[model samples]
Target: MPSDSDPRTDTTVVAAPTPVSAERILEAAHRLGLRYFVDDEGDVGIPWRCVVVHVIFQDTRAVQLRGTWHRIADTEHLAALRSLVEDWNATRIGPKAFLTVGDGGIVRLHGEITYPLDAGMTDAQIDDFVFTGCRLIVALVREAEEVFPDSLRGSLEP
Candidate 1:
């Protein structure tokens, strides 16, 4: 088949998949016991971080799994970062939490936080948030090393 409007009338054009983002890496890390916070209302009343960790299984055996340790981050950039992570998790790492060794054990993890200086947000507050958030992420990553398989440890290691 051939068409003037179609650039690749005979050839198939395939687009590459999107890459993962620091947020998703952080999210997965959170599931493995990481935490962070995102300012929602701009009120900044008290420090808020969502922590949800559970264990599920592929069977009815009720086998427990590692929990997530996620903290909060700036709400403005949440959407963009989340999109990046989802893409990375899907394309790069497939749809598995724990990668098997023989199955090309490679995972892409981008641990980052975007805290742009807002005209309204105070510097001291931002500093506090970053300090707390960084500590939480670092601690969780360190602890996860013991639990996560050697092959599946670290940020984006093959």
Candidate 2:
């Protein structure tokens, strides 16, 4: 028989997984002391130095953390940017990086990481996921800055 002080004698309580929701994601951001904004579409966005990380839910079954780098590249640089994105995606383990071209041939960079929460998640799991996503995306932006110093239009400080 185990004694009263034995480790096996202590009862452990397990927390049930909480349903995924925008409110829960916002709450996690709040707990991290991050400044976040809700868009007209109810999207939660956390602005970083040169990126805005958005937390979006997909039918409550998955969460996508997306970061948009606020730098513009001309169409002339499309080939180089595409090569960079391809190399980044090939070598990086997380937050798939990609490029988008808008009107007037403006090129933009984006990074995204997704987490499937089909079975829900505990508070600790949610917090860790949010934190990890943000860090990885930010790292991608920093690398972009290093690789294309003249591409940035605004200050990366903040």
Candidate 3:
């Protein structure tokens, strides 16, 4: 039973379940196979290459993911990595990289996935964020290895 004015009257439509609270978001994180630490305030911290995401709780119904890469402490290494990151950002396909050169001459690079989850996210939607973020991290680590052949030496650490 559908009315002519109903948007779903012409095609099959299934609404996505929204993930709004800390518990549901944590569940989605588990489904993504990622180890997450949720604090008393309902913030989420999950590991990523070079960066860590602090999924800050907004209202009871929303959150925002912010990631900051680890800083390279050596001045020479920092400069070298910055050059490499700049080159890769110009060529590689993914979210645009953001960076900072802070005190102690450290260089840090970070990237964010553009998942529109204002209301929250479905499990599938959460997967989109997790998968895309991991891929981008891999790409960055590969490019960084090329920049510091000796320092980067082996694969990403556990």
Which lDDT tens digits does candidate 1 get at residues 42-114? 1111122322322222232222223233422233333433554455446542212221122233332223333
- Predictions in order: lDDT: 0.34, 0.84, 0.61
Using lDDT as the measure, the top candidate is 2
Q: What is the TM-score of each candidate against the true structure?
A: 0.26, 0.86, 0.63
Between candidates 2 and 3, name the one with more favorable TM-score: 2
Mark the 10 consecutive residues where model 3 has the least summed lDDT: 149-158
Q: How many backbone clashes does candidate 3 have?
A: 0
lDDT of 2 by residue, 120-144 (tens): 8887788888888999999999988
Q: Please list all clashing residue pairs in model 2, or write none if there are none.
A: none
lDDT of 3 by residue, 16-108 (tens): 656566566577678878877877865777776556666655455445555665544345565566677678779877645666766655556
Q: Is candidate 1 or candidate 2 better by TM-score?
A: 2
Q: Which structure is stronger by lDDT: 1 or 3?
A: 3
Give the total clashing residue pairs for model 1.
Answer: 23
Cα error of candidate 3 at position 145, Å: 3.4
Q: Supply candidate 3's per-residue lDDT for 90.
A: 91
Over 4 Å off in model 3, which ranges?
1-13, 17-22, 39-41, 48-51, 56-66, 149-158
